[model samples]
Target: MKFISWNVNGLRAVVKKDFAEIFQKLDADFFCIQETKMQEGQLKLDLPGYRQYFNYAERKGYSGTAIFAKDEPLTVSYGIQAPEFDHEGRAITLEYPNFYLVTSYVPNSGAKLKRLDFRMGWDKAFHAYLNQLDSHKPVILCGDLNVAHHEIDLKNPQSNHHNAGFTDEERQSFTKLLDQGFMDTFRHFYPDKEDIYSWWSYRFHSRDRNAGWRIDYFVTSKRLADHISDSKILTDIFGSDHCPVELLTNTL
Candidate 1:
């Protein structure tokens, strides 16, 4: 099935940016979105064949996530365990017959490392949550993880070493996740590929110049790696500072 993830930047904004056209063309069986930046009744998407699920932050026009799936999930959950985490509406989990699909908008560490501690706490809790889900069944985690996994995942590693999303601590957290039995699908397919990215800075014409970071991802339990078909970055698509990333898999 085709599983696609994109940080629309803002759901309302993308609708005006021909989101419907891009959505139709993708025709993903499972469409996951991050950073929706809207709340209930703020906007409506009339996608006919998909079951819609949304988690909105208590604060309006902030972080949020939504999932549009072709097949109705057996169960749907919001957040992992913390009410604090749930309040931000950063995660949505949908359980299918075979696996659990988690769409997340991972909290950013902020420009000056102000939230670095919070970010690290989140990484620990989120990783634990993934393990809990994995104990039940394989998990497919997607959306903007908000961190560059390694030097290869970002355009300028040396310059960004101390930046919020590219810091050593953040990168190591991602490494821990992979070491815990998860595989980043895109890297699995193209380990040597460079200069490919998902999210770009809105400043300095980053997107136009293709100076970006691959913070978004399609990661799955190591056991599901065999079923991964294709992982791609849709860099040509326009709307948000971030572009869509896709994963084709047999496990669904």
Candidate 2:
């Protein structure tokens, strides 16, 4: 099976670009996107042969997520089994016969780490939620997790050390998740591969210079690691600040 994840940044905006063309080009079995920033029925999407599922934030045009899959899931869930965090529409889980596919747009720690505390809480809750799913079956989690977990995951690690996405707290939380039995699929396949990133800053010609962070990911239960066949960062694709990240697996 093949899965693709992208943070469209804003679905309303990207659809005006090349979203339709790119979506057709990838043609993934499961296409998950984060930061959709649109409410239900807010945008009309005509994706032939794909079942589209959306979770809208209570606040209009804010944080949201959606998943487009060729197969309709046995069950679909909107949140990570939490009510407070459900307001943002940050997570959507689809239960297939073999696994649970979760797409999440983790809350970004704002400037000066203004939302750091809330982000930490989210990490804790989400970790437990994933573990609960893993107990039943392997889980595939994807989206812009909003953290550069390692120095190698970002370009300006030294300078970004204190930044929201690269802060010690966020990085450590990511580590905790991994230590708890999830594998970062990209790094699992290409640990030493450098300069390939998913999300780039529009400022400072970051994308031009390939200065970006590998915050978007496709992670799974450790036992599913052996089934992973290929993982890629599609830097050539464009529509949002983030390019699509992909995963191919035999066990899916």
Candidate 3:
């Protein structure tokens, strides 16, 4: 099975910019999206052979998530089961007989780290949510987790060490999450691959210079490591600041 995750930034906007073409071309079994930035009844997509599930934020035009899957899930759930953090529509989980697929648009810490405290709380809640799901079955987690786990994950790491996504607090939280029986699939496959990233800043010609961060990911339960065949950053295809990250598995 093939899974793809992309932070489109805004679903409505991306639809006007080659999103249809890109979606058709990828043809993934499961396509997860982050930062949909739209509320209910805002846009309707015509996608045949795929079941669409959306968790829209209570606030219009803000954070949201969706998943389009070729196969119907046994059950679908929204949010991380924490009331305070569920308002943003940042998470969606699809439960299958053998595994659960979860995607999230993790909250950013903000310009001057104003929301750093909230982000830290979210990290703990989200990690606990994943562990709970994993206790039932293996998990296939993806989307824009909003952190560059290591120096190798982003360009100009030295200069951006204290930035929102590169902050020590954020990085350590991610590390703790992984330590709890999860695997960052991309690094598992390419431990030393350098200069590759999934997201770029719109300013300063960041994408052109390849000065970007590998914030999007396909993380899975450590037990599912052998089932994963490949994990890749689809840097060549773009309709948004963040590119799609893919996971290919042997019929998981």
TM-score winner: 3
Clashing pairs in 1: none
Candidate 2, residue 60: how far the Cα is off, in Å: 1.3
Off by over 4 Å in 3: none
Q: Write the per-residue lDDT of candidate 2 for residues 1-252, one digit (tens) a residue.
A: 889999999999999999999999888999998999988877899998999999999998899999999998999999888887889999999999989999999999999999999999999999999999999999999999999888989999999899999999999999989998999999998998888899999999999999999999999999998788988999999989999999999956
Q: Mind giving the per-residue lDDT tens digits that candidate 3 earns over 1-252?
A: 999999999999999999999999999999999999998898999999999999999998999999999999999999999999999999999999999999999999999999999999999999999999999999999999999999999999999999999999999999998999999999999999999999999999999999999999999999998899999999999889999999999987
Kindly report which residue stretches of model 2 are placed more than 4 angstroms away from their true locations once superposed: none
| Candidate 2 minimal-lDDT segment of 10 residues | 78-87
Model 2 scores what on Cα lDDT?
Answer: 0.93
Least accurate 10 contiguous residues by lDDT in model 1? 79-88
Best by lDDT: 3
Residue-pair clashes, model 3 = 0
Superposed Cα deviation of residue 221, candidate 3 (Å): 0.3
The clash count of every prediction, one per candidate, is 0, 0, 0
The lDDT of each candidate is 0.93, 0.93, 0.96
**Each prediction's TM-score against the native?**
0.98, 0.98, 0.99
